[model samples]
Target: MRLFLLAAIAVLSTLRVAMADSAIGFKQTELPADAGGHALTISLWYPAAPLGKTETVGENAAFYGLEVQPDAPFLTGSRPLVLMSHGFGGSWRNLNWIAGALVRQGFVVAAPDHKGESFTEADATEIVPLWERPRDISRTLTALLDHDDLAGGIDRGRIAVIGHSLGGWTAMELAGARYSADLALKDCNRAKLPPQCKAPRLLGKVGIVGDGKADPRLAMDWRDARIRAVVALDLGPAAGFLPETLQQVEVPVLVLAAGVETPEIAAIKADSDYIARHLPGATTVYREIPDASHFSFMQICKPNGEKIVEELSPGEGFVCRDGGGRDRAALHAQISEAILDFLKVDMR
Candidate 1:
């Protein structure tokens, strides 16, 4: 019996090594100037022939990175495409962990760094006007479908989107949720303003309101019909979304909110619930992750990551924090499982 048990353990170890040998393919590409004249940097992760040397990608002193075969040949046959959007002030690396999980499940994930909102750059003009966010994803899809190497491997019919924070708002817009500057201003004017509305803006701006009716860009429809499914992670500025547009969304949406609520921010009920109420009951699903925080959706941090982050940039170490003592990897696994299950139902 002891010999048999030892043999079984050896076999399992070999299987694990085999699985690790098959690595995800990762590469970075640049897109031409978008409509707003901003160059977009995109990161793609997909199934590739297991041939190249595996190296750690997206790693920094503060965060752990995923081991992938960089620039490997694309795997044969078409596969589903998933576009990811990072939160404000974040880059494509924020969703790197989730991208790897999806790629392991036979998916092609593309994430673009929004011009001004990205970590590399910050411009009030581009950041203030949120309508441009959805357009970025749309342009990314169009460009990829005609690309030299990836266009043939993308299953355009099974395209979906995953976004966190402001990215979540972007996904909503792409899912047909229209923005209303007037509504947003009204919410900002209330006795208790939303955290985003209360925060000081760059360029000496106080709030997002400035002649809401006259500013046509504030209410433009930025919906992308090609997006079949959407997964929004703790989206904000929910008050700005027009109820009628939410009800009109034809694409399926899976809204996952953080279980732990922050005091300074509005409750999840006000944001996720408000949007869920207006969405078509048959197509929308809202789920809250227990013991997870807004930043929990980001990439996993290394041991002593918070200390390193604080040393580098004080008061910003909160990026490495999560609800309670929950393991970030466990949280990420749960989140990825939920997303894959949800997409499986809709991405058919």
Candidate 2:
């Protein structure tokens, strides 16, 4: 009886070890570019069997210098790839929780920090064009598809993209969706700006207000045709242009809106509604978490931290109750589960 109990315990421990060993990492190589010298700091999280050689990439390192995990298990051959982009002024590391969770569930996750954005400083004089960020994603996908080490191990055809805030707009654009011109017009009207300035600018300062059409040309290059699904979290509304851009989207979309009262939450809901109504052939799923806030989707604020949550949400106070009573770690796990479930249906 004693021997059987010991054997059972050993088996359980080994299984746990095997689960931990299922992921590996690899380095990200900068892509050669003629325009603005594009550079991407990326990390890959995939399935693996436990060999102690693999190191978990830290957030800062993954966002700056490319870091890789090695010897990860490639469950049932090459796994599906999910490319994630962070919001403006946000680092790719913001999505690490989700990425790690997905990797554990047998998916290859690639996340890139957009140049001139993220934690890296951008030229203050020249604001990086919002339209160009999505191109970074497209370029990274191309690189991953071509890389020898990941070539046969990745299912290029079963690719997905997930984004948050401004990143959400990029995902929608990549799906060939257009936004309403009226949305932009309303903002410009409210600004008391001259009617003539309402015309969409080809290139200019892009803001949530008075610049809806700024990213008019932001959309996936159908010629490349790699991604199949998209998920946008806490996306804000369009400002300067018309509805034509979002109308072109044809892929399946999942929009996660945290709450409606807050500015950030309101923005996400508006974007989700626009996509759900306008995109033809689009199967849109919109979910609203009762007590979640925009910051809840990321690790930006925490209950145990130095009152970042209170500083951000003055009215609600610093209690974690406002954020569904789930701490940062739990929130991340919930988000990962939601995202993976969505992908399982859409990607397959």
Candidate 3:
């Protein structure tokens, strides 16, 4: 009887491990570009049974891609495809926690390291040409959806996008479906910068053409892409085009704001509120995670990081001024669940 009890316990543990392992399969590939011989590294996370193969790709490449852990489990074939983009100076790995959680819930997540940005401080100044990065995303999607390996694995008709900071801005622009020139001009004036901006102007440009549209560029068309939903997290101050351009967005949007008390936070709120009020066919939801800082959503927080311990205390990760004694995993889980829930209603 003792031997039988022990055998049963061992079997249960093994089954649990096997169940977890069956959910996800991870792989990395370098996607070649047509222009200037440039290439982008893309990481693909997909649904798989416990018996699927798992391989490790080492060392997180900040400006490139990182492999998803082989042991992660994903619900098989019930979920849709999600494409994620990282914030400025963030590598594809910065959002691993979010990606991993999404995969576990059955999403096939594809994250690309933008052409020029990554995790290191040295690459901090290397912002990819604004429009170029979004184009990269579009192309990457084309590749993923068309690839032999992933062809039928994803539900192309039900796709969603999530971005952080700059990436958030990209997601918003993609959903707006069209651009407006007047909106760009207003963003420049708000920043108190001169109008009639030229190329590479970070402050006053009407679209992504110049310095990446702090004024918000509305000078182009979006080619009527089929993205069904968008979520932007912790985006910066208005560029000229956001207000006018946002009105053109035809799908639902959710904006998550951080650091409400700070000047930057205030600016972001203003922009977010403006979009919520004006965007057509858009239902916007805004929430603030108290004491959370700009970088809290990413994996940059140290053990005693200011934003980590105080604002989010007793929730996720260490204790600090932002929040104390917060569990990072729990916070991430909430974020992942929120995203999944949003997609379920909006993407369907």
Best by lDDT: 1
Runs in model 2 deviating more than 4 A are 1-21, 24-26, 35-37, 53-56, 59-76, 122-126, 150-152, 179-183, 191-203, 207-224, 239-248, 260-266, 280-282, 300-304, 307-324
Return model 1's CA RMSD, one decimal: 7.2
Clashing pairs in 1: none
TM-score of each: 0.87, 0.73, 0.70
Worst 10 residues of 2 by lDDT: 59-68
Candidate 3: Cα lDDT at 110: 82
- Cα lDDT tens digits for candidate 3, 4-64: 1113456535544544654556766888777733577887777565654554342321211
Question: What Cα-based lDDT does every candidate model obtain?
Answer: 0.77, 0.59, 0.57
lDDT of 2 at 208: 24
263 Cα displacement, candidate 2 (Å)? 5.4
Q: Evaluate candidate 2 by giving its C-alpha RMSD to the native, one decimal.
A: 8.5
Writing each residue's lDDT as its tens digit, candidate 1 over 4-98 gives: 11134565355345445456999998887845756778898987779858998889999999998989887666667899988877888899999
Mark the regions of model 1 whose C-alpha exceeds 4 Å error after superposition: 1-22, 34-36, 121-128, 200-207, 210-214, 263-269
Candidate 2 lDDT, tens digit per residue, 10-60?
653554455564644544445666474465666566665554565545433
Against the true structure, whose TM-score is highest? Answer: 1
The deviation in Å at residue 167 for candidate 2 is: 0.9
